[model samples]
Target: MTRYIAYIMCPALLCLYLTGCDFEDEYNVSPRRNFESLWKIIDENYCFFEYKNVNWDNIYSRYSPEIEEQMSDYDLFRIMSDMLDELQDGHVNLLSSNVGISSYDGWLNGYPSNFNTEVLRNTYWSRSQNYNDIVKHNRIVDNQIGYIYYGSFKESILEKDLDNIFSTFSYCKGIIIDVRDNGGGSITNSDRLASRFLNEKTLCGYIRHKTGKGHDDFSDPYPIYLTPSHGYLWLKPVIVITNRKCYSATNNFVSKMKVLPSVTILGGRTGGGSGFPFTSELPNGWSIRFSTSPILDVDKQHTEFGIEPDIEVDLTDEDIKENKDTLIEEAVRILLN
Candidate 1:
C-alpha cells in the first residue's frame, strides 16, 4: 500500500496527484464509465462520507440509472454535480472545460453575513495609520487596544511583518485580530500568524487520511501542534473576530486559537472547511476536487461543519447604517474590560 503525508492547509491551487489505483482500461469515453469513475474516485477518497452519514451506495442506486450513452455533457454534468452536492461540502467541486465548474456553496449561503467590508474599512480600519496587503494594524480605542485586519490567508506573512505589528502594539492592553469574510488561502500563513500568540508548544488539532477504500477505513489521528515563534510573542489578552466567511485555512486557525488560554474567539461561528482537499481526474478529462483528509480539533472532534465562537455576534442593521462593525466593537469592549 502506498502512503503519502497530506498537508493540513488550503492553498490557492492544491497539488493534484493520481490515485494509487490503475484506471487505464477504464479511461474510455463512455458516459456510464466516466460516471462510475467519478463516483468511484470520490467514494474511495472523500473524507466526509461516514462523518456526514451519506449513503453512497444508495446515492449510486438513485443516480447511476440516470446516465445514458447519448446524454449531453450538460445533462451528465448536472447529474454528477447534483450527486456531489448531496455531500453538502463547500470544498467539493467538479470542473470541466466543456461545462465549467460546479460547486456546493450552501455552507455559507444561508447564514447571516456578519461582516461588511465597507463598514470595516470606512468606519474602523480607515483609522489605521499602518496598512499593507497582508494586514492592517494600528492602535485604536484611545490607543489602548491594537487592531489588525487580515482579509486573506493566501498572502504570505514574513517574520518582520509580524515583528513590526507586535512592536507597534507592545504598549496596548490587548489585540483584536479580525478575520471575518476571509475565504482562506494557505495554512502556512495561518500558523505563522498564530505562532506569535503562543507561549509554548500546544496541541491544536488532529488529522487522519483514508487508509483503505472503506468509508470508515482511516489511519489513526495524528496530533498537530503549534510552537511559539522565536520572534515577538503576545501573552496578553487576544480576541479573534470571526464570521461565517472564515473558512478553510481560517477555520483551522480558529480551531488552533480556541485552545489557547489567552485567546478568545468572538463573533459568529467559523465557516468550516476542515478537510484537506485533494483532486482526482475523471476519464472524460474532467477533474474533481474534494475533502480527502479529515481534520479534528484538539479534542479529537470534527470541525468539518464549523467551530463555534466563545461569544457569538452578528452585525446589526443599525450598526451597518452607522458604519460600525458590531463584532469589532464587541471585541474592543471585551479587550478593554
Candidate 2:
C-alpha cells in the first residue's frame, strides 16, 4: 500500500498532516466510544508524549475504566478534560456547545503574571503622542528612547504601519517592544513584525509532524526561516519585554527575536505553546484541539515549557505602588547605558 502525505497550513506556519487512514470511521456515538475516540486521537497525533514523559498507554489504562454507557455528558467531559490536563499544555482544549470549552491552564497557573496593563497605560503609553489600533509608539525618557506597545498579534500589522512607527523613532538611541500579556494570534503577523529587525535571511526554528501512529513518529525537522523585511528595518539595539502570557505565536516571535544579535529579551519567562495545534472531531460531533506538530528553537531544542529572558526582571510591590513598570525601567536603563 502506498501512503500519501498532504499538508494543511495552520497559524504559526505549522503543517498539519493528512495520511491514508480514516480514523474517524472506526468509532460511534456511545459514551465509551467517544472516550476511546478522544484518547485515540491524541494517542496517534499528539506530539509531546515522549518529550513530556507521559506514558499514554498508562493514561489509557487509567481513563478507560471511567467511561460508561449511561454516564452524563458533563461527567464524560470532566474525565476527558482531566485526561488532557495531564499533558499540561495551554494549547490543548476540548470544545462543545453543550459543555462550553474545556481547557488546561496549568502552563500559566503558577507563573508570575509580570504584566500589568493599567500600569503600562497609566505610566508609559499615556505619555505617547501617537497611537493606533495595532501599536502604540512614542519616545520616552527625555525623548531619547523609542517605546512600542504591541498588545496582541491578532491585529493585522501592515508594512506602512511599521514604516510610520520606525520613522517616528529614527533618531532614538534604541527601542523597547513590549509584548507582555500577548496571548498570541497569527504567526504571519508575528513573523512580519520580527522581519523588521533582521538584516538577512536567518533560520529561526524548525517544525515536524507525525508520520505514523507511534509516539516517536515524526518527520525530520524542516527549517523555518525569517527574511528581512523590504520596507522598514531597525538595526539599532532592541529590548523585548515578555511575561508568562506570551504564548503560541508570541512565543514563536520571542524565539526568533532572541537569535538576532541586536535583540535582548527582558522581563519574566514566556508562556510556551511550541506545538502547532490541530483539531479532530469526536464521535459525538464535539471537536478537540491538540498539539499535533512540535516546533523547535534555532538550536533544535524544545521550548515547549518556555524561553527564558536574557535579563530576568519581575514586577516588585514597591514598583507597582509607584506605578512604575520595572521591566520597562530596566530596558530603558539598558538602552541608555
Candidate 3:
C-alpha cells in the first residue's frame, strides 16, 4: 500500500495513475487512498465551493502533508474531519467509527441563541394549560392569539393536525409559530406547513445541482413553488419566531412563509442549511455528508449561509431573570396591534 501511494505521489506517475485508474474501486484502506478518496469525493460532488468562496486546492495543500501512511485511524479521522470543517456548513459532517461524527459548530457557536424554551413554557403555561399533542399549539394570553411552538420539521405534521390546531384558535385574531431551536428535518414537512399559508401557487425559491466536476459547474436554477393547501387555510396575520437554531427545512419554511403578505418573521437570523445534503463514503469505510444542491430565495440569492429575520431581537439577560421572552413579547405586541 505504501509503495503504491508513493508511486502515485511521484510527479510523473501521479497523472498516469489518476487518469487511467478509477480511484473509487481502489479501496486499499490505506491512509493515502482514503485521504485522496475523501478529498476527491468532496471536490467533485459537494456544492457551495463557489458560494462559500473556498479554495479546495489550497485546503488540500495545507492538510495533505499531515496525512502519513503510519498514522492511526483516529489521527486520520481527525485530519479528515478538520478538512471538512473548512466549509463552515452545518450540513457538512464526517462520521467515523473511532470518533463518531464531526459537526460544524460555527453556524450557532458565536450567534446569540435568542430563545429559551423554559422561559416560554413557564410564561405561557401559566395562562393556558391546554395544548394539542399533534400540532403542539398552546393558547396563551386572553385566548385572543394562538401560539404554537414547532420545534422540529422532522415531526409529522398532517393536514388534520393543522385543522385541529386552527380550530382551537378559531376565535384568535392572529397566530405565532415559534421555530426557535428547530434544527430542521424533512423538506416535505416544510412544504406541507407552508402550503397552509398560501392562497395561490407561489415561486418561493430556486434549486440547482452540480453537472460537472468544476466548482462553477451547475445546472440552470430551477424554480421551486408552493401551492395552497387543500386543507384549512389561515388568512389572518401570522408571526414566525425564529432563532439561530432554525436550520435546513426550517430555514426553507421561513423563506416561503416570509413571502406571504400576512406573515411576519421576527427574531434572530436562521441557521441556514439550504443545500439538499447527499452522502458519500471514504475508502476506509468512513461516511461523509455534504450539501450538493444549493437552494436560493425568490431573488436568486444563496440562503445556504442563513436567512435574516424581518425584525432582529435577541434574548436579553434581563428577560431571562424576569422569565420573559423578548422575541415572543415583540411578536405578541405586533399581533395585538
**Which residue pairs collide in model 2, if any?**
none
Provide the overall lDDT of each model, using Cα atoms, as 2-decimal numbers.
Answer: 0.89, 0.89, 0.87
User: What clash count goes with each model?
Assistant: 0, 0, 0
* Sliding window of 10 residues with minimal summed lDDT for model 1: 1-10
C-alpha-based local distance difference test score of model 1: 0.89
- lDDT, candidate 2, 65-103, per-residue tens: 988999988999999999989999988999987987988
Q: List the residue pairs that clash in candidate 3.
A: none
lDDT of 2 at 88: 92
Shift in Å, residue 142, candidate 1:
2.4
lDDT of 3: 0.87
Kindly report which residue stretches of model 1 are placed more than 4 angstroms away from their true locations once superposed.
1-27, 129-134
lDDT of residue 311 for candidate 2:
98
Which candidate model has the greater lDDT, 2 or 3? 2
Candidate order by decreasing lDDT: 2, 1, 3
List ranges where model 2 is wrong by over 4 Å.
Answer: 1-28, 129-134
Candidate 2 has its poorest 10 consecutive residues by lDDT at 1-10
